[model samples]
Target: MKEQFAVDVLICGAGAAGLMLAIDLARRGISFRLIEKAAQPFHGSRGKGIQPRTQEIFEDIGILDRIVAAGGVYPPERLYHNDGSYSDADVMERGKPTSAEPYHLPLMVPQFLTERVMRERLMELGQIPEFSCELVDFVQDADGVTAQLAGKGGEETLRVRWLVGADGGRSLVRHSLGIGFPGKTLGVRALVVDAVITGLSRDYWHRFNDGDMTRQISLCPLAGTHLFQIQGPVPLEGDIELTAEALTTLVAQRTGRDDIQVQSLSWTSLYTMNARLADHYRMDRVFLVGDAAHIHPPTGGQGLNTSVQDAYNLGWKLAAVIQGAPEALLDSYEQERRPVAASMLGLATRLLEAQKHGNMRRGREVHQLDIGYPESTLSQEQPERLDGLSAGDRAPDALIRGAAGHPSRLFNLYKGPHWTLLGYGLDRDAVPSRAGLHIHTFGPHGDVIDEQGHFYEAYEPAMGDWILVRPDGYVGAIVTHENLHALERYLLQVGLGVPGVFNG
Candidate 1:
C-alpha cells in the first residue's frame, strides 16, 4: 500500500541546491517537499570554500549571519619545497567591506556546517526536509510531475506542479529523462579525508608538492573545529587500505615529515575529476540543478557555490510561475544557467591544468562576483550609452538616507522576494504602487536621499531614468522616461506582470 501527497514543487535531494530551493519556495508561500536519500545530513568538509557572491546570496536569504559566525577567513598557504625549503603565499586576498560589496572574501566553513545552518533557517521558516527519502521514479506531463518515493515509513506517491533534481552527479532524475551528460574524465583520483592530525600548525594551509606537481598533499585546518580537511592525489597502481594507518603512512611519505601522525579519521572519500554538463538543464516540466547539471574539479572551489547560485536563480522564477506568471518563463532557466555552468566548467578545468603546471595560487576570478547574464533574453536595455551596469547585471548596493531620517541601504530595499522600481531623480509620487513591486525615490525631498552620492554614481540614472530589479537582484529593465506604461510592458515581457497591471 502507498500513501499520496501533493506540493507545488518536489525537490529530489537535500544538498545545498535542493535545500536553498526549498527555503526560497517556502518564503514565497509556495508549497514544496524536500527529500534526501541519506538518513542524516552529510558529515564532511567536502566543498569548504563559500565564495563572496554566494555569501551575499546567503545574506539575502537570512542565513548569512549564522554562516559568518560558524566560519572564518581563508588562511594563507605554506608551500613545502622538495629541496627542504619553504615559503608562504596568500591563497586568498582579503578586502574591507564596502557599500558596493559587503562580502569581500571567500569564507571557510565546513560543508557540513553550512548545511546545518541552512537546515536551521528552514526550520525557522516552518519547513523541514525529510531525510532517508529516495525518489525511485518520476514521470511528467503537460500539467505536472508524478513521482514515486520510498522513505523510512513506506512508499508514497507525490504529485507536484514541478520537479527539481538537485541530486549529485549520478542523478537518477537526469538519467531517467535520457539527458546526455557529455564531458571527459580528467583521470586524477583524489583521496579526501577529515581527521585529527598531529605535527601540523593550524596557522596556514600546509601543502606538499613534488617538483612536477603530479603528486601533492594538503592539510587545511577547518575553522571552528579541531579537524583538518586533507586531500592528495592517489597513484593509479597502488594498493592502500582506506584506514587510519594507511592514510598516516601516505601523508608522512608524501610530505617527508616523520612526526606528523594521523591521530584519527572521522570521514573519507575518493573522488575522480569529471567535468561534465547535462546536455540540457530543463527537460519539459522537470529541471536539473547543481551537480545534476554540471560537475567541476575542486581546483577553484566552485562546485558548491555554483550549485547554490543555481538554486537562487531558479527559486524566485519557480515562485513567480506558480503565481500565475507565464509558463514560458521557465524556458529562461536553461537559457541563462546552462551557459554559466559551461563557463564554470571551463574555468575550473583551466585551473586544474594550471595546477598541474605548478601554479597553485587561486586567483581573483574564482570569487565569482562578476558572473552575470548580460545577454539574457529577460534583460532589456534602451539604446543609450548603457555604461557601468546595464540590464542583466547584478544591482550594486548604495547608502542612502530614508524618509524616517535614518541611514538605509539599497540592498535593504531589495532584500525581499519582490521586484523593485528605483526612481533616481523623481518625485515621491512619481514611483507608482504595484503588487509584487517595491517603489523607492532617491533624490532631495523624496523617500530617500542619496546623501553620499553613491547611488547616483553607481547607477548614473538620467533625470527620468527608472531601473527595475528582479527578485534575484539582477537589473531586469532600464527605462529612461517617466513612462509607467513602458515599465508595465517590461514587466510583462519578463512574465512579471499581467495584461494591465504589474503582478505585485
Candidate 2:
C-alpha cells in the first residue's frame, strides 16, 4: 500500500549532508523526513577527514566527541616528499588565526564513520531515516512542496513546506530546477585505497611525488589503514590504460609500500577532476546542498567538509523559516553559502590546476586561506551591528570554564538550539538569566568541565568579557560587558518567528 506522511521539510539522499541536516533539524523539534536509497549506512570511510570548522559544528550539535570516540581520531597534518625527509604544514594555521581552536586543524575520520556517528545521533533524536526511499518527482507551490517518493513496497506522496536535495554530484533536484552544472571531465582516473599500516609515518597527510609529475600519492592516517589516494597522469611505459590494477601497481611503486599489505579494503573508487557548480543554489521552495550544489577538485580535501558545513549553514535557516521566521531569512542561506561554495570550488580548482601544471608554489598558496567570509555579499556585516551576524560563515571552537568552574569546550554550550550568551568580568557568577536566553560565565581561571571539554591551557578567548555565541557555535553578536538592544535585534532578525520585510 502507498503511504502519505507530511513534514515541514523533505530531505532526499541520506548522505552526510542529508543526515547531518536531518539530525540538526530534529534536535530543534522541526519535523523533517530524510530519505536514503541505501538499506543501511555504507561500509568503509568515503572521505578521510573532517575539518576543524566542521568539528565545531558537530560539537555544537553535541555529538562530535562521540564521533571522535566511535571513529578513531586522526592526528596532525603531515606531508611527505621523495627526499626521504618530510616537512608538514600546520593545518590549524591554514587561515587567519581567529580566537578559536578547532578551526585550525581538521580531525580525520572516514565519511562512513561520519555517517555512523550522525546516524547514531539521529537515532537518539528518534528520527531514523526513511531508508529504501528514493525521490521520484517533486512540484512546488507558493505554500509548500509536494514530492513523489518510491521505496520497497510502493510509491508514496509527501507534502513538505520545503525540499532539500542532498543527493550528491548527480542531483535530480538540480535537474528539476533546470540549473546548469557545467564541469570539465578529466580524462585521468585514480585509485583510492584505505587500510591499516603500522610502519608508515603517523603525522597526518603524507604525499609522495616523483619530484616531478610522473606520480603523486596522498597518505591519510585513519584508524587502521592509512587511507591512500595516488594520482598521476597515466601511461607508465607505453599506450597504457588507467585501471585499478594499474593504480595498484603505481601505489606499490610510489609509496615503496610493496610489502605493507592492505588489511581491509573499506572503500575503493575511481575519481576525476570534476570542477563544476550549479548555476543556482536555490529555486523556489526547493533548495540544493552539498555535492548537489558544487563539485570541486579534491586538492584540499574540502568535498565532505564543505558539504557538512553547507548543512550547518542551511539547517537553521530552514528550521527557523518553517517555525515562522521571515522568508527573507531563508533566502539568505543561498546568498551566504553559495559564495563560500564558489570560493571553495575555485580554490580547489586552482589547487588542482596548479598541481597539474606543475606549479607547486601556486598549489600551496591556493590550498591556504589567509582570509575568509569577507569576500561574500553577506560578509560585509560585522559582528558589531546586528544582534547576531549572518549564520553562513564557519563557526569557531573555544575552550571555556563551565558552571561550577568545570573546563569545557565553548562548542559545548551550543549543544541545543538557543541563544547562548557567555559573559565574564561580571562582579557575580555566570548562569542562565532572566531573558529566557541561556547565559553562562567563565571566570578568570579556566577549568576543564567534561571529557569532551579539553582545556589546552593555551589559546583562550579574552577573559573578563561577554561573548554571545549562536546555537551553531558562531559568534552571532557580541557586546561589551553588558546587555544591549543588539540581543533583541538579533533575536528578531535571526530567531524563529521574526519579521523580515522584503523590498522587492
Candidate 3:
C-alpha cells in the first residue's frame, strides 16, 4: 500500500518556472506540491540575466526587491583578439528607469540564486518544495489526476486536481502525453562552467574569439559573487569532462592567457543549442510550462524570462479555476503562452544567428518588454479607433493620489490576485462592487487622483472610460461607462464572475 496525498496542483521540477508557479499558487492560498527530482536545489549560473518585463512580474509576486538586492546590471563587454589585445564597450543596451517602467535594465543573478529567492518566498507562504521527489507516472481523468511519485524512502501516490510539467527540456510529462518537440539541434556545442578566477577584471564581460569568429569564449563575472561564468565551445571529438582541471585548461587555451587561473570550480555543463516547442501546452488536466513546453537558445536571455512569464500567465488562471471560476479558463493558458513561446524561439534563433555572424550588440529586442498578447481571446477592445492602451496590452504604472490624499501608484493598487477596474474620469463610486474585484477611479474626487494626468495619458481613455486589468497585469477589457455590462459579459466569458452591482 502506497502512502497517499492530495493537492490542488502537482508541479514537477523545482526550477525557475516551477518555483515561480509554486510561489504564485501559494500566495493565492492554493494548495500545491512542488516536487524536484534532485535532492537539493540547483546550483548553476546558466540563466543569469533577468529581463525588465520579468522584473515587473516579480514585483507583483513580492520577490522583486530580493532579486534586485541579489543582482546587478549587466556589465559592459571587453572584447579580446588573438593578438592579446582587448577593448571594452557596452555590448548589451542599457536603459534608465522611468515612471512607467521601474526596471528598465536587465538584471544579472545566477539561476540558482533566483530559485533560492523564489523558494524563500514560497516558504513564507507556508509551502516548501518537496526535493528528491520524482514523478514516475500520472493518469488523468475528467475529475483530476493521480500521479505516482518516488523518493528515496518509497513510492507514493499524489492525487492532484491538475498536473504541471515544468520538468525542463526533456519533460517526461510531455513525453508521456505524446507531445512532439520538433526542432533542429544546432551543431554548435558549448561548455559552461562557474569557477573562481583571478587576474580578470570583474568590471566587464570578457570575450575572446579568433580572427575569423569561428571559435569564441567568454568569461563573465557574476554579480554578488567572486566566481565568473566561463563559456567556450567544445570540440566534437574531445573529452567534455566538467572537472576543474579540464575547465582550467580550456580557459587558458581559449583566452591565450596563463595568468588567469581557475582556482575553484562549482558547476559546469555541456549545452547544445536546441530550439524546440511542445506541439501543445495543454492536454486535458495536464499541462506543460517553461522548458517543458519550449526549449531555445539562451541568446537574447529569453529562455528564463519566457519561462517565468509562462508561470505568471498560467498561475492566476489555475488559481481562478480551482476557486470555481471555470474549467475553460485553463484553455486560455495554452492559447496565450504557446504563441509567446514560439515568438521567443524565433527571437532567440535570430539573436543566435546574429551572434554567429559576430553581431553581439543586443538592443531592445532582447529586453522582452514589448511581448504581449494583442490577439488573445481574453482581450476585449470595443472602440474601433484605438490609439493608446487597449485590451491585451501590459498595464503600465503611473503615480497618483490615494483616497487619503497621499501619493501612490497604480501598480500598488494592482498588486494583488484580483481583477482591477479603472474608471477613467468617471464618478468614484460608479464602478461595480463584488468579490475578487477592485475598483478605482482615476480622476477628480476618486480613490486614485491622477495629479499629472498620467493615467489619462497612459490609458488614452475618453470620459467615462474603464479598463479592466486582469490579475496577471494584462488589460482584459476596455470600454466606456455606458457599456459596463459588456465588461461583465467579457468577465463571464473569461471565467470570472460579474460584479454583483454598480454603485454610484
Clashes of each: 2, 12, 0
Rate residue 193 of model 3 by lDDT. 88
> Using lDDT as the measure, which candidate wins?
1
Cα deviation at 357, candidate 3, in Å, is 2.6
Pairs in steric clash, model 3: none
On lDDT, who's better, 1 or 3? 1
Over 334-377, each residue of candidate 1 has an lDDT whose tens digit, in order, gives 88899989999999999888877667777568888888888888
Arranged by lDDT with the best first, the candidates are: 1, 3, 2
Global CA lDDT computed for model 3: 0.84
Candidate 3: how large is its RMSD? 2.9
Model 3 residue runs over 4 Å out of place are 1-5, 210-214, 498-504
Clashing pairs in 1: 435-504, 436-504
Q: Write the per-residue lDDT of candidate 3 for residues 223-338, one digit (tens) a residue.
A: 97888999876665566878777667777877777888888888988877899989999999999999999999888888999999999999988887877676787888989989
lDDT, candidate 2, 1-504, per-residue tens = 533448889999898899889987888788888998777767655665666567666777778777677555445555556666766555433444443454555455777777888898899999898888999999888888889999998998888888999998989889988999986765445555555444455656566663445576665666543454334454323444344455456667777767544444445555655778888888889889999999876666678878887787788777766665567777767776777777787777766666665333322233222223433333322234443223323344556555575665656666776656655444333432433256655444433332333322321334444555545545555454444454545555655213332110
